[model samples]
Target: MSRPRLLPWSNVDGNPCYLLGDGTGSSYLSRVADNVESVQLDMAEELLNHAADLLCDSDSDSKTTSPQLRFLAARLTEALRDVHRIACSRGARLALPDGDDDDDDDDERTDD
Candidate 1:
């Protein structure tokens, strides 16, 4: 029997789950991963917004001792770690800003 492709998420037993797919961006498993990543990112954004609101409040430092604040921070940290792993596994790259230069030419081209 062919070995199943391992998914990004784990099963109930903390074992890696497998799916049938070619691993390309258009594959079924890949699509599922993409959707999951999107939701994870959305959750992260919301969490950050909430945290920001809390921090911006005048009584934020006093409120930080609350259980709810701690829970939110813990959840956000877990989500961050998960998203980082997913990004690494998917080989996602961030485009770096161009250096301070007047020439705005593409790097791929060279003057021969």
Candidate 2:
């Protein structure tokens, strides 16, 4: 048995979810997770763009209202949480070199 994969979303109670697998990433749930993560990342990108637009507008005479800014902040927070979860899940699944369990070197490298 292999280490269980951390899922991108939590349970109804807000606890992290996991998927037990045999190491091969061909399971149905794996595909679903992949799709979901993709969607989440895309949404996050869109939200970031919207936030930039809102802030830019606020700099001009078309000032953004307090309620609109509040709503945007809330959505940005949710998007950030999803993106963080995806990063954690993917980072955990990365394969390290054999006989090298320490990830100190990884700190110097950035994923493209």
Candidate 3:
């Protein structure tokens, strides 16, 4: 049996979703996930740009307000979550090196 793909989005109950396929990316759901991931990454880039602009504004008469900072923090947190999910899903789908599949603990080691 082929390995399941970690879907980009979770279920309505906040659980991670998976797709069992023949390891091909031609499925409709796979294409949709790919598109969603692309949009998510693009949005993250745009958010970072906006954050830089908001943080670099040095006008004394128009200081960054506490509410503005709070809102920015919330948006940043959401973006980070989405990016992290995408990274995990993609990472799980990556092909392992030869003879490297048995060393799952290698990734958990703190020392490089």
Candidate 4:
């Protein structure tokens, strides 16, 4: 089989997902990947905030630990891993395939 043009994201089972495209990161799968990545980033931010709150709690000292804190830590780790994978997949999608050099640039086109 041939290589896929678009590398969107992995499934919940951690399987690879592929899409046929022209190497431009503008396909429907790519858009979905973008949206999912945005959500994951938002989630990561929220998780960070939650972790901070846990750390700032008066009962949470260096000598003690809580079940909630442990659970949140585990969840946060998992979420971060997911976000990292998605980021890698998005990066792969942005990469130009073998001989395709057409610049579908996102840089601003200024009128001089």
lDDT of 2 by residue, 31-75 (tens): 999999999999999999988888876474367788898999999
lDDT of 4 at 66: 81
Candidate of highest lDDT: 2
Model 2 TM: 0.83
How well does each candidate superpose onto the true structure, as a TM-score?
Answer: 0.61, 0.83, 0.84, 0.61
Q: 1-112, model 1: which lDDT tens digit per residue?
A: 3334445688899876666554345776678877887888888888889888887888877757678877887988988877776666555333336783436566668889
In terms of TM-score, how similar is model 1 to the real structure? Answer: 0.61
- Please list all clashing residue pairs in model 1, or write none if there are none: none
Cα error, candidate 2, residue 24 (Å):
1.8
Q: Please give the RMSD of candidate 4 to the true structure.
A: 9.0
Best by TM-score: 3
**Cα lDDT of all candidates, in order?**
0.70, 0.88, 0.88, 0.69
Candidate 3, residues 3-30, lDDT tens digits: the string is 7888878899999999888788889999
Per-residue lDDT value at 2 in model 4:
28
Comparing 2 with 4 on lDDT, the higher-scoring candidate is: 2
Backbone clashes for every candidate come to: 0, 0, 0, 0
Q: What C-alpha lDDT, on a 0 to 100 scale, does residue 81 get in candidate 3?
A: 94
Residue 72 error for model 1, in Å?
1.5
Worst 10 residues of 4 by lDDT: 1-10
